[model samples]
Target: MFQASKVAIVGLAFGAFLAPAFAAPAQEAVDRTFERIAAGVSRAGLEPVVDIDHARLAAEAGVEMPPSRVQLFSDAAVNSALLAQDLSTGLDLPFRALTYAGADAVQVSYTSADFLKRRYGLDDTEALAAFDAALAPALDGLDGVEPVPVPTEGLADGYGILTLQSAHDVPETVARLRAIVNAQSDTVWFGEVDFTAEAAALGVDLPPAVLLLFGGPAPGGVAMAKFPSIGVDAFCQKLFVHAAPEGGSVVLFNSIVALAELHYGTSAPPHAMLDERLTATFAKALE
Candidate 1:
């Protein structure tokens, strides 16, 4: 096992983003380390959903970046509990771990449970504990890697998330969003997750929720080209459609502007045109 004793849990005065990193063996490459982590997740009995190669995606757009990949795994039981507590958590669902080549060593990172609780206002302490405990084995035997803190510089405080009220119900809202994405020449359809059905398969009841995963590779490559770390979490765009208590559905997604600031520490992230396109797309979906 790696140096577990060196692992430190620290916080900041502002809303701290809990990103814990683990270092690979000295001789291990990023891809090898990635495989190791994936094998560990399987050993822990978690289902591997998808593995995104951000570096390759950037190369497809004629941009060069370090070897970086983000693999998403699923523990239906834990995810069901989180969604049962708050459907909004679906925005960050199906747990993701980022494996990237750092300046000196290869590292694997993921958003910590503490950050999830603060981000979604989750009050279920037991659920949060269960989440941490479940993923612990996948990260075992790796030494801790910490990031240098940077100032937010008065960026938007909304955590890069945008929520809109949809005039249609959940399924229709998803359909509309899907239509809009399909119509856009620049965007590509990735996949979709029906959270309600997923939970039902596990015999856990959850509210109506569906997560849409899609992205415009051109824009994504542009962002990753400039800020390689964005590939860690923001490569694939997500639109979460869930039933709203007030009748219509609610659509939620991440804004690249906010993501650039929060994740990459870009003081003046260049995301105007991309944000405009996204705004118009979602506006049409909601309408």
Candidate 2:
């Protein structure tokens, strides 16, 4: 492991220094990755672009020892997620990222930051720290925004998915999400929010929101029989539906990677640096 003494010094040297470089390139990478994956899936066939069916994916991957479907999905991708060989495409960027190799030859899975630090090796990884520094700007600033109501974004019959990487802090991420929901409700049920406990055997805390998905128009009526999160590990990924009567939109507060921090989702920068590979992942998710 490499010591990121330099990043620490940089953080200390510029407590208030602002630079244009402080941006969240991870988000862009995610966007692109998802888009391309979506395309790949489409080219492959007609269905979800990437990663779907939380319970089934886990069961096939062997993560069904405990908890329920909700918990299964939440923990599946967020903190203690499991994935099949097929849906495991890796993400690249300045997200607090932790990943696992899925059964799928081409797919790579993700986890949260706290989970990564407490269980995985991202905390002291020099390359990982550099990744975070590169993606810090896009993840910072959760101190002063007033919680506003979410405006609803109408759902079009032609629906497309926008998966996030999450910021870092959970509470702040939730708060920011609450603000977004309040501002927009027509599109509620903001994606999925997976939570995990420990995956020491495999390494790392469990990917946060790797499967936590949010969608629009009344829970999307998706039957998630095993979805369970409360008190399991203080790990939860419940869907907060935000909508008036006619319209609303669902948008994650930040990259799910950022939200993986749990209570500290927006506190620090990201763990994984935004690279072309990660950027490619983001693009694939949308395809």
Q: lDDT: which candidate is best?
A: 1
Q: List per-prediction Cα lDDT, in the order shown.
A: 0.68, 0.26
For residues 1-287, write the lDDT of model 1, one tens digit per residue.
Answer: 00111101110111111112323332236667777778879889987766666555544545555666676777888888999988888888877777777767776767667767777777899989888888777766544543221223443324677888997988889889989987987665657778888888988877789887766656776776556565545666778889999899989887777767776566234465677778888997677
Error of 2 at 80 (Å): 4.6
How many clashing pairs does model 2 include?
118
Which residue pairs come into collision in candidate 1? none
Which segments of model 2 are wrong by more than 4 Å?
Answer: 1-170, 198-204, 207-212, 218-287
**TM-score, predicted candidate 1 vs. hidden true structure:** 0.81
Each model's TM-score, in the order given?
0.81, 0.21
lDDT of 1: 0.68
